[model samples]
Target chain A: MITVSIEKKLRTYGGGQALKLAAEFLTGSVTKIYGPSGAGKTTLLKMLAGLVRPEKGKIVFNGETWLDTERNIDMPPQKRKIGFVFQDYALFPNMTVREHLQYATHDDAWIQRLLAVSNMTTFTSHKPAYLSGGQQQRLAILRALATKPQLMLMDEPFSALDTQIKIVLISELQHIFNELATTVLIVSHNLSELESFDGNVLYVGNQ
Target chain B: MDLSPIWLTLKLAAITTLLLLAIGLPLAWWLSRGRSGIKLVTEALITMPLVLPPSVLGFYLLLAFSPQNGLGKWLLHTFDVQLVFSFPGLVLASIVYSLPFMIGPVKSALQQLPVSLAQASYTLGKTEWQTFTCVLLPNIKPSLLTAIVLTFAHTLGEFGVVLMIGGSIPGVTRVASIAVYDAVEQMDYSSANNYSLLLFAITFFMVMAVFIFNKYHAKSPLE
Candidate 1:
């Protein structure tokens, strides 16, 4: 289980907005965080992943202290072992689709399996620029899963896909998440899109 | 025709380019990561060479290393080394003279890349240096090429700095540019033309190669 109580300041157009929240996520549970624009949903994901720092917080994952501002114990992102799917996809233009997976892990069998699950086996040699938006998005998800990370944080991960692809991809990924028993937190503006996943909903608001 | 000047110029340009790459890459990486008053001031100093006259730098180098100034005198006494009117002095001048060419494009290219690229690498458990070399630097290949070409060419074409710091000493201090001037002063039009044509041709090919390569491999929009 991962427990977090954190506060961060957001630089909004209006003024400085404070984001404070406390929650506990059970191991192997999938949760969706929905909020309006500028609601700091992404910031929360970043803080959890150790990409962003919380001004005041204590985050404990499976009894490991990832962050404790009062104790001055903050784990870096490299040590967090969280798989992140960025909002922009953030694919490396220089690397082929297969290389992205190869960079994450050396298990060729797992890499081949991931490519097959994403239906990207035929396009493994292609760079991100050559892939379509949906293809790029799928590649991003597969790359994140390459490590088989125990915790996954995704920010609007499927905004580019059509309904059919989204439905199929999520279904495929759910099986893998269950197999790995990964705890997943996904942020999205539209919660209905994730209805098929049937995960618990967490609503975030800016203050 | 004596070709030592041509060889010496090539040697200088090659050494300077290598040395600058070693120093400039890390410096540019550091400077691109953030903004601070000190960083801005350092960037301005690096960029000053682009606008300031080369002779200004040449004059300062000459004064500081003339064996009369304290630093020069100390070096001369302690290390028995002389910088004034020497090939080493010419090298010092070229590095300062060509610094901006090596730093500008690299810093700008690094800054232009999406910040998410590095963050993504970090989440993948990659180290900061690995992210830079494996992810960031490869995306900025064209910029690195441009920086290297411009620095080499600019160093090859240096005149005022070489002349001010290193007087025309054959085979040691006299480079092709100074050779051309020396040839012209003696009304040796043929030798001057030879040096000028060779320097022009070398620079032309280096620059042309960069342009052609960049056209085919321009920095991608995604980068």
Candidate 2:
């Protein structure tokens, strides 16, 4: 299970305000995060992934304290073993599709399996520049799964895919998440896109 | 054609370029990523050579390498080495004079990279060094190449700082630039013309090659 209670100061266009959030995620369940623009949905994901520091917070994952500001205990992102897919699909420009997976793991068989699941087998040597938006998004998802992370945080992970592809990939991803027994958190403002996810929703906004 | 000065100039540019890469990588990385008050002070010190008059920098360097100053005396007493009027002194002066050429390109390249790339690497369990070498270095190859070529070319053309610190000594401190000055002072136009032509040809070839390579292979993603 994962538990978080955090507060952070945010500067929005209108004015400055404080963001406070508290939540608990079961060990192997999917959670969808939905909110208006600038509601700190992305920041919440970043904070959970250890990419951002909250002003005062405690994040505990499976009884391990990832962050406890009062006690001054903070484990860096690398040791936390979490997977994150950025909204921009942050693929390394210099690395090819195969190289991206190889960077995360030495298991060639696992890489081959991931490529097959993503239907990217033929594009292994292609760099991100050559891939279409949907392809790049799939690559981002595959790369995040390359390590078989126990916790996955994805921000609009299916925003670029067509409806047909999104449905098929989401089904495949659900199977993969179940097999890995990984707890997943996905943020998306489009409700229909995440209809197949079968998860609880967390809303963030003016409140 | 006294080839000794040509060889010495090449040697100096090569060593200085290599040293600049060693020093510039970490310094540029720090400058690009760090958010601290001390970064401003360090950046100002590094950029001093860019705007300050070369002769003024040379004048201070000459004093420091005179064997009368603390650094010069310490070097002499510890290593039996004299910096002033020596080949090593020429390299030291060239490094200072051409520092901005190397650091500027590298810092810009690093800063332009999206922060997500580094964050992705970190979540993959790669250490900072691994991320820098495996991810950042490969993407910024063009900038590194430009930095190297510019620093070498700049060092090759340096005059005032080298003159003040190293002085003209045959096959020791006399580089191609200094040799050209000496030949012209003696009305030896033929020797001066030869040195000038050689420098022009080599420096032009190197710069052109890098530009061509970047155009064909290392074009930025924005392009």
Q: Each candidate's lDDT (Cα)?
A: 0.92, 0.91
Model 2 lDDT per residue over A35-148, tens place: 888878888889888888999999999999999999998899999898999999889999999999999999999999989878899999999989999999999999999999
| Candidate 2 C-alpha error for residue B200, in Å | 0.9
Q: Which ten residues in a row have the lowest lDDT in candidate 1 chain A?
A: A10-19
Q: In order, what DockQ does each candidate have?
A: 0.80, 0.71
Chain A TM-scores, candidates in order: 0.97, 0.97
Model 1 lDDT per residue over A1-207, tens place:
999999999886246888899999999999999977887899999999898898999999999999999999999999998999999998899999999999899999999989988889999899998999999999999989998998999999999999988998999999999999999999998888899886788988853
Q: Positional deviation of A18 in candidate 2, in angstroms? A: 2.1
What value does the lDDT take at residue B76 in candidate 2?
93
How well does candidate 1 score on lDDT at residue A131? 97
lDDT of 2 by residue, B1-223 (tens): 8989889999999999999999989889889995788988888888999999999999999888889898888999999989999988888888888988999999989999889999999999999999999988788888889999999999989888999998899989999999999999999999999999999999999999998989997756422
Docking class of 2: medium
Best by DockQ: 1
